[model samples]
Target: MGFEQLAALKDQLAKQAEEKRMAKRAQHAKPAQNAKPAKQAEAPKQAKPGRAAPTAARHAQAQKAPAQKSKPVDPVVLSIGKLQKRFPKAFPKNPAPKVPLKVGIFKDLLEHSEELGLNEAALRDAIKVWCWGSRYWACVAENAMRVDLNGQDAGQVLPAEAARARGLQAKRQKTKNAAAQGGAAQQAGADQQGSAVQQDAVVSQDGSAAQQDGTAQEERAVQQDVAAQQNSTAEQDVVAQHDDGASQQDTPAQQGNVA
Candidate 1:
């Protein structure tokens, strides 16, 4: 019901998403079983157009994800859905902008938790998730009116709370930008590597008969280097994003945000 449990729930949801993405990617990938084509494996076969497969798979996954997500309503999300129905003014349905919730709203929900058939943990997670979204953050601005359970005005959003939301939103944007830059760098590297491989293959085909074997080995080494670089960069980006998220989800900050 506190930050500890809330953070755990947040992490579990994130982990599930990442796992699904990886699984989808893995399914879309087709590894070549017929290897060691020594005769024509020269110059690394100029690198197959395998990158497009993953890209296409990701696009497909994005299209299908929402439909799939709607089917699996966990207890926490189910509770939140019920809350949305029970208190439409406080928790408006989608397409209506979310409002800033009254400060200390968690305590308010606790009073109804038993009657609503929700436990402390589920209630906490549900509310945390509701507040954690960017839509909710956008609503937590200066002078914003906080809504009570009955959809009545409770209080005004404090400068401190608005500042906190802005800071969290800034961090979220920064992390996203960093990851996007990393992806861009990786793509550029892959393109460069592919171009080099293609040029080398052409040179080999242009009567460099004796150097074909050496050329193949060199291409393999270059591919390995590129792959290692990509992996290291991606891991660093993920860690940075994770740390940024953990900091935002801490006790004090999340309390103000959730409130």
Candidate 2:
């Protein structure tokens, strides 16, 4: 009976295992339902050809824009105002400093010795230094003297004029030097020309002397020829006279014999 019960229990376990395998097979083999496909929507249409394109009105704003303008200033008038403001005591009515105002000279003084107080000697030294230590002190000193004599700021009236004068003097000197060089070259050319003419004259004189010598030799030869001809003619005349005399003497002898 125990063997029969054990065999029955084994058979029951095998049946339960077979049922679970079948359930798993059924779950895997079931087909999924077919899903409905989503409907495709149509794309929107473009604008028609007859319709006008939209544009902004911003371009009209550019026409009404303001233009930039500059104000003009006169340099001389501005300089006068600036001078009056800076030096009210001296330049009361826009008077500049009473110094010889060479630009390079003043610049040097301002750079090296600002405390020199714009005196004539200091200005002259500055000018001399600026001119590469040239002895043009007299020029600046003369300007200073002129300013002292007139009792006014020399720079106000004479700065620009002196600058112009210096430029003009430099130009004149350059022109004078050029003219002198040209004259020297011309003189040298003229001397060469004169030498050449003298050489030609000497050559002509020598040629004339040689020609005269030849002419004199020819004249002597002609005189010798004439003398020879004259001597021959005289000898012939003497022989004829002798022959005539001999003939006359023979005729007289023959007559005496015939008688």
Candidate 3:
């Protein structure tokens, strides 16, 4: 082979190698540029309204639902002061010291109403109008009422049977008093009858004794009069006999003389 032919072939080989390396570099550079455009395109897609993330919307909706789910205020839990301020006619003043001001008592009263087959609205109204206590919740407690004891609230504080028993005891005591009065009257009548019988006996004894004394005095006077009459008759008879004798003698003498 010739030297000029060898040099020309080597140059041709070197040029082909450079062209292959350049083509590979151009391919890699083209791919890098295309990746940047794709990232840009993806950013615009995220910003578009139609491509919004449903997960974020769902999370926001969940947060809003919790805020809206808070409960409302109950009407049966009204304060005495507030009730007096709002409706003075129903609630004249605040609850007394003995009255139940605890919230638990109010809840128990509502529960008791429910047990009696009352509705929530009915209980709520009763709390406003009937359960507004001054000295005690006695108006409501004695009639569907409540009380506070030992820092706790109780419903149906009074027992009906106990009240009835107390009433019965009072009635019995009254009856016993009446019976005692009646017995006293009967004893008084007996005493009066006994006194009357004793008075009658005493009067009869006095009358009988006086009659006997009058009979004895009459007998003694009659005897004395009879004795005196007998003596007088005897004396008169003796005198008459003596006088007749003397008169006989004198008459005889006078007759002799006259003859």
Best by lDDT: 1
Candidate 1 Cα misplacement greater than 4 A, ranges = 1-71, 205-245, 248-251, 257-259
Model 2: how far is 8 from its true place, Å? 99
Q: Candidate 2 vs. truth: CA RMSD?
A: 43.2
| Shift in Å, residue 38, candidate 3 | 99
Between candidates 1 and 2, name the one with more favorable lDDT.
Answer: 1
Regions more than 4 Å wrong, model 3: 1-153, 157-163, 206-259
Error of 2 at 204 (Å): 2.9
lDDT of 3 by residue, 156-200 (tens): 434552243244344444545555554554555455555545555
Estimate every model's Cα lDDT from 0 to 1: 0.78, 0.45, 0.48
lDDT (tens digit, per residue) of candidate 2 on 173-246: 55455555545545554555555455555555667876666556555555655554565555455545555653
**Steric collisions counted per model:** 0, 1, 2
How good is model 1 by TM-score? 0.61
The digit string of per-residue lDDT tens for model 1 on 1-259 reads 8989999999999999999999987766645333444575446434356554667789988998775444655777788898998889999988999999988888898899878888888888888888876888899999999999898998998998888888778767767776677776677667667766776766675676636864875677588667857775876668586665667565567666555
